[model samples]
Target: MIKHDVSHFPTILVFNTTEKDKTSVALIKNGSVKISEKSRRAQELQSIVEELIDNNHIEIGEIKAVAVLEGPGSYTGIRIGATTGNTLHWLYRMPVIVIPGTDISEAAERLMSGEEFDVTTYFSPRD
Candidate 1:
């Protein structure tokens, strides 16, 4: 098996707003889940992220990449997650991963394995 250099992705922030009521956020570090939270509402996404990181004593600068689920679910939710991830990428110049499915752990693993994703700034989920 080939080994991948995932040193650059020490910490990854993940957003999964594909499910309307189950919107969630996670922080993956060294291929382990440091924190995971389900947002009570769509508007809570930002606060959820902040709370998770703050509680885990993780600083924003420690995050090397951002992963967001590019939905087959709620359009509004997809927009929220995608917009947040894209905005972070633009601000921090970090890689933004667009996941096409619901498996957050799988996506994180792919990143840890040095898999590349095509990230786009705009998102328009099917209604």
Candidate 2:
């Protein structure tokens, strides 16, 4: 249970399952990342959600929106994360925003440099 003060911002839940090393679920508030959990197994999805819920990191009703990584990579991983996000959005009547995995890198680059940058990123299949 990791706790941080994010009371001034809208809570956004983000799930990324595009690549193994980069797979993660994060909570963002006021333009800063708050809580983040990363894992490789698809099975860890439930635990990740439970961890967020159990810790009171995000209140169900207070979730402003949900963001999911819509991928051109792991089909199963993307589906798992999307399903979770969709279910939550439907259950709580929150808006769901789908962001492609590639865009996330681009966004990070823009944020850091304050300028647009071009970069290539992808996920390779497991043996």
Candidate 3:
């Protein structure tokens, strides 16, 4: 439901560990992507992120943006995940986008079922 220019950033880092019960981490670049949702997100978040990028052979500098599934979940987890994206933005000088989590699940489900998914714009705090 938030809007901003996403064209400036091609590669995106997605964070979805807002829910304590269900969590995931994803890294996306062009047509290559990796995602994991095997639980213990707190312990696996960092490593998954590293491995996702590493396995994909994407350099850290190539990540042009970050997207976070924000809210409607564990408060502490959301803050921690969002904070990580914020830190990335601060270090990389790219945009950090915060999106509503409620719809993200539905979108993901649809995608898994080979259904159409609407491409929505993202919102950045710096804007």
Give the whole-model CA lDDT for all candidates, comma-separated: 0.73, 0.56, 0.62
Candidate 3 residue pairs in backbone clash: none
**Which residue pairs collide, candidate 1?**
none
* TM-score of every model versus the real structure: 0.80, 0.64, 0.72
- lDDT by residue for model 1 (1-127), tens: 1233443677889888877777678788876785465747666789989988998898898998788887677778888887788788788876776767876667666666766565544434541
Residue 50, candidate 3: Cα error in Å is 0.5
The positional error of residue 108 in candidate 1, measured at the CA in angstroms, is 2.7
Q: How do the residues 1-127 of candidate 2 rate in per-residue lDDT, one tens digit apiece?
A: 1222223336666677766555666665556664445655655876775676567655667776666666677777777767777777667765555554534444322223333222112212221
- Per-residue CA lDDT of model 3 for 1-127, tens digit only, reads 4355453445777777766765676665554456766566544567767877888887989988777776677776777676777777777776766666634444233233433222233333233
Error of 1 at 34 (Å): 2.7
Report the lDDT of model 3 for residue 116: 29
What's the true lDDT of residue 7 in model 2? Answer: 32
